[model samples]
Target: MKYRNLGGTGLIVSEIAFGTIPILSGDVPVLPDYYSPNEETAIAIMEHAFKLGCNLYDTAIVPEYGDAEIKLGRFAAHIGREKIIISDKSRYFIGDEMYDAVNRSCKNLDTYANIYFVHQVDENNEDITFGRYGAIDALNELKAEGKIKFTGVASHYYDVLLRGAKDKRVDILQGSGNILERGMLERIESEPLFKEKGFILNKSYAAGILPHFFRIETLLSGVLSYPISSVLVGMGTNEQVDQAMMMKTENYSRPSFSQVMSVLEKSFVPIPCDRCQRCRCKYGTEIHIIFRQYNYYFLGKDYWALRKLDLSINESAAQCKKCTDMSCMKKCPHEINIPETVQMIQRLVEIHIRKSLI
Candidate 1:
């Protein structure tokens, strides 16, 4: 297994870090079978990953219903906590809630986390993040107490995260970047500060959008080409763990950015939206998120992904029909028909929700 320094944290992590999300079972009622492994199976997979030289483990509180943290804590205790690097995330917005979340995580994990992330910061909640009683202050307080070794932010917004990195506010940046989603990649290449900091790349599979055979090899190689510190994969089974190890050990040529991009463009039907967020909906809709979730639903064809889209659809569906001026369609740089796409999603969401209920 190959190891790299996670940004400037001084912690040497495996190139392929084990993400604990798949170990969870029945956490999301909408998708009970979605990556849900039994406790024994989950532990066995994680132990196998450890045998393959994976020392970095990531988990979150709310998403996993605390099951992941509890199980991981038990496993860490069994294996000796000092031997591995454990990272966890909290989704709480306020400082007090953030503090409680971290405390609960530490207690469950049986030790202090190596890195504690302020999870999912984006343009929509930038104000809450940097506010006086926000996650930043909570993380700072935790760091002072020696409850966590470092503070990080996992965000989808490149520009917002880049500002934090430039100000030296965050020690690590966990962002999504793949062949199709290249925002984070663009920032890393152009910004020296971000390149120099600790970066852990996630969503390399684009929520399982990539095909299986070339998924591990292509995605790993593509991410490695950048100055990223680690690539996080939520390996659900022993075979998946083995595949990641094999990809690292094998001497295969890594695909260049252009090559991968060309393949993606040729293989998949083009979606006009580039997620530029330039198209302003008259009803205050988040068009980019809608399209992104649509892509996930199209590729994954899973209830969980569909359910996520349903939540967004609920917010914007009513407003979409009221706007006949089509301002968003005109403003889109890619000239995508925003109203038409929203209508399609509305129909799809209804169909899927009915099926799930039945």
Candidate 2:
């Protein structure tokens, strides 16, 4: 496995870190069965990955809750913890809740994490993350107490990551970057803060859409071409572990920017709204969020993605009916019929809600 320095943490990590979310089932409300492997298979895949030189393991609170950490801890004990790097994440927990979550994570993992992350902090909720008794404070306290060696922020938003990097408290920054999602790659290349901090790129398969080898190769090549520390892959099977190992040792040519763009365009699923933000609602409706949620739902076909959309709809859908002026449709760059799309999404949400009730 190719190794690289993890930002300024003085720790060396494999370029392809093993992400463990796909390995276990959980009680997380959305898509509980999605990507879950049996315990035996999960353990075997992880062990095989370790033997193949994948030294970094990342797990988050969602999807598997603490199950992934417990399994990882058992594996760590068997293989010797010192031989691997453990990365854990806590999502939206703050103050005492954050402390309790970390404590539980450590206990479940059976060792202090080498890197602990404030998972999924975004620009919209920056205050909740950086405010009093927020995730940052909790992470800082954990670091000071020596429970975790380093603190990092995992965000889908570049602006939030930039803020975290500038805070100087964060030792690592994790973001989603793939051929389909190249915004983070561009930000990392151009932004000094991203260069200065440890950057771990995840969602390389665009949340499991690009499962075919050819698509994976194109996406991996595009991401590997960037100057980042590590690219995380969710390997649920032995074949995937082997493929990751092979990719590291193989001399595959990286795809050009234009080629990557071509692939993305060819593979792209059409989402009518372009998120111009020029579309104004008299009732202050967030139409862009609806479009984004629908995009995720359409691409993933997973209930978790839909659940998020459901929540967004619950919050914003009411306002759409109140808008007298159909100004959003006029403002759309693609001139998409906004009202028709919103109604379609509303019907889908209603169907999902009815099914869940049944």
Candidate 3:
């Protein structure tokens, strides 16, 4: 396994970081799968990954990731905390809340996190997170106090991450990308501002759906082709650890967006959004995120994706119909029919919700 510097932090980490979501014992509905291995089993799986050279482990606080944080602390103690780098995060947006969250995470880990991110930052909470006494400030204070070595901003939206990149307080950025949704990654590659900060990419397998349509090496190679510090994969078993870590590193060319779409064509008509976040909604809806949920529903996250779509699909569709703005389409490089696609997804949600009731 090849090691890479995590930005300019001077910390060396494996190309593949261990994501602890799958190893958590719980019925986390948001998660794609529910494989709750016992503490002994979870430790063994992580230990296997460690032996395979995975030094960076990422987890969140309790209730968000269930007992995974505590389990990670136990594993850290078992393997000697100094031997590994821990990356922890919380969903709090306020300064006081975020500052307290980091302390709680330290207690859960039984040691300091190498990096602590303000996770899932988006437009709704972007102001509070980046504003005065926001989560970023809290992280900065924590860094000064020696609680966490680095401050990170993790978001699914490109704009949120761009702001984090521009902020001097942030040391690392975490985002999602895969072979199918490589549009954001493409944009990040073209922008020089992102090169100054470390990037850790998750959702490499599109929440474990792409693996069914494409080979593991294909997904890993495509995402790894970009300039990033690490690719986080949630491994639940020893076999999963092997599949994620043992990619053929030599002579693997990154697959083009067209090639990725071609493979998905065998399964279903995937929305060509690529999640660039170029389309802005005046109605305060996340158009790209909704489109992703539509694709995810068909890709095996049926109920979970549907539930997310149900939250704003009707309202967003209504907004799309009432508005006369066509800028969303005009700005789309793929020229996707924004209104029509939204209506189509709305119909999909209605159909699924109706069928489930029967």
Candidate 4:
């Protein structure tokens, strides 16, 4: 496995960091699938990944990742804690909550995390996470206390990540990208501010859905082409570890975003939105994230995606219909028909909800 500098951290990390989500045995309703390996089996899988040159092991606190952190702690002890880099995270955004969360994470891992992130940050809580005595402040405090070596902000939206890039407190950024949802990654690559911090990308397979539509190598190579420090792949079985670790990251020609969309088009009518987060609704709706759920619904996350859509589609679609403003379309580089697409998404949700009742 090749290595890259975890930007400005001076720490070398494997191109493929081991994602600990799938190894946890739990009924995590959010995920469409999980491996549910026993504790011994989970540790073995992580250790195998380590032997394959994967030094970065990423996990979250209990209940979020369902005991994976504890298992990773055991694996770290088995392998000697000094040999690997541990990345831990929690969803807390308040200063006190974040402070306590990091301390809990350190105890769960039996060692301080090399980097800790405020996971799943979004526009709703971005201000709280970055504000005075917020999560970032807590992480900074933790860093000074030697509880964690670095601070990070993990979000799916580009605007939030850009704020993180601009903030001197943020040492690393985590986000999702894949061959299909490469829009945000494309925008990130062009922005110079991001180069100052390290980027670790997850959902390279779009939460394990894209692999059914595209080759794993295709998905891996597409995101690997970016300047990201590491691309995380969720591994459960040892075979999966081999499949991901053995691929040659360099010298592989990656398909363009259009080419990836074309392949996906053969399966279903893909929403043309790249999730760039540029199209803002005068109403508080997150347009790019709605588009992402629409695409994910067609990509095999029907239940989870539709559930997310149910939260705002009705209201957003109503607002789209009532509004006369066309600025969202004007801002879109792709020139996507935002109003029409949102209405179509509402229809999809209605149709799916009706079908499920039958």
**Candidate 3 clashing pairs?**
none
lDDT of each residue in 134-201, candidate 1, tens digit only: 88888889999999999888887776678668756578888887765654575576678786678888
Q: Which candidate has the top score in lDDT?
A: 3
Instruction: Rate residue 58 of model 2 by lDDT.
Output: 89
**What are the lDDT scores of the predictions, listed in order?**
0.75, 0.73, 0.89, 0.89
Among all windows of ten consecutive residues in candidate 3, which has the lowest summed lDDT? 349-358
Q: Order the candidate numbers by lDDT, best to worst.
A: 3, 4, 1, 2
- Models 1 onward score TM values of 0.81, 0.77, 0.96, 0.96
Task: Residues 321-352, candidate 3: write the lDDT tens digits.
Answer: 88898678878988899999999999877875
Two-way TM-score contest, 2 vs 3, winner: 3
Off by over 4 Å in 1: 29-40, 62-66, 249-268, 272-283, 302-358
Residue lDDT tens for model 2, 40-86: 77778889998888899988753345377787887888889899998
Task: Compare candidates 1 and 2 on lDDT and give the better one.
Answer: 1
Candidate 3 segments whose C-alpha is farther than 4 A from its true place: 351-353
Backbone steric clashes in candidate 4, count: 0
Tens-place lDDT per residue, model 4, 115-163, is 9999999878989999998999999999999999999999988889999
Global Cα lDDT for candidate 1: 0.75
- For model 4, the stretches where C-alpha displacement exceeds 4 angstroms are none
